[model samples]
Target: MTLTQHWKEIVNLVTQGQRSSMHCAIASVGDDGVPNITPVGTVFLRDDHTAYFFDSYTSQFAKNVKSNPNVCLMAVNTKRSFWFSSFLKGKFSSAPGVRLYGTVGELREATEEEKSAVHQRIKPLSWTKGSKLLWSDFTQVRDISLTDFRPVQYPKMMEHLWN
Candidate 1:
């Protein structure tokens, strides 16, 4: 199926994962040819096929992306209730996880609109003292052009659905 066809499902899965865990894992290859994975909480999906993440605390990941733009982002719905219900029913009502393969664009200053959106997303944590220190200074972002989407499937758990 085309990427656009699955865009809505992918976005839903990603949003669920973000709400559950507050971050997604981004994988890239380092200069030593080793795989690097970083948990990034500032990632935001602009649309079905495009996303961007603030480049505040991703020094290693940024370096890896600069050398090899190819990257994969994985998000999982880790809510206890969702997992328990799915396992009990022996099927997932929706995808449990999703992987997005894409190429990273150059890092540039985040626009005012982007900053405002990010602030709104993290407003729940604004009461914490560390929120200011951690979320501030997100002046730059790296855009990702999603090229592929893969849903995590458990054959035994949802064989009938796939069939």
Candidate 2:
């Protein structure tokens, strides 16, 4: 299906994942063909089937993407309470997560708007030293052109949860 068909649902699940864990695991293939999964915290999804993430501390991921742009990003609502509630009811009120397959463009400087968005996202934690040490500077980004999506499924629990 085209992204437009399930765009809203994809967005919702991504938001849930972000709110729950503040990060996603993006898989890429390294030069030796081994898979690498990186925990990235700066993923930003757009309404137009695209996304981007800051590349501040992901040197290995950056090198892998340079060789092969294909990537699979998996984001799940990892909140303990959400999973507990689903287990109690034997069903999920919604899909718990999503996986997005996409191609990353060449890394480039982040724009003012993108920087501003990141600042806003981490504002609640801005006062903490850890926040300052970790999230203070986001200078580069790589744009992702999403091509496909797979909803996270738990057999019977996730049936009919599609948008």
Candidate 3:
């Protein structure tokens, strides 16, 4: 399929809340000239075309992004019906690192609408006595521009889900 088509599917998934987590990979030149990939749990989506995630103040993923600024963000839907297993291989990527290259955007004052939308979508996912779902405190907003996108592959497993 065309890249744009792939992007549209991803956007739909995010907007529809079908995809729960974002898989972010940062390929940075290590001291030994090797590339490192760090996946982070994403938490926010400002719009269908924009999103954000929470990272520790001293996370290696954040550090790598600061240094290289090149990254790839991916979203996948693996919860399809049993009949659609053939499409289980479907995946999306943000065009190498061009989709999110450069410094991340700063967190701005969330509009009333933005806040309402966030509240409607997320209900504090409390799990334990001290386990509060981590949020960036409305201060860790990152902006990644869209460059390109594509579906990875089509697998029979997808039919089991999609079906």
RMSD of 3: 6.6
- Using all chains and alpha carbons, the TM-scores for the candidates as numbered come to 0.95, 0.96, 0.55
Residue pairs with clashing backbones, model 2? none
TM-score of 1: 0.95
Off by over 4 Å in 1: 160-163
Q: For candidate 3, write residues 28-119 as lDDT tens digits.
A: 44445556665544434433455555444426555555555555554444434421543343532221111233234443455555555444
Higher-scoring candidate on lDDT, 1 or 2: 2
List, residue by residue over 30-50, the lDDT tens digit for candidate 2: 898999999998899998899
Prediction 2 TM-score vs. true: 0.96
Candidate 1 — worst ten consecutive residues by lDDT sum?
154-163
lDDT of 1 by residue, 84-103 (tens): 99989988888899999999
In order, candidate lDDTs are 0.88, 0.90, 0.43
Instruction: Indicate whether candidate 1 or candidate 3 has the larger lDDT.
Output: 1
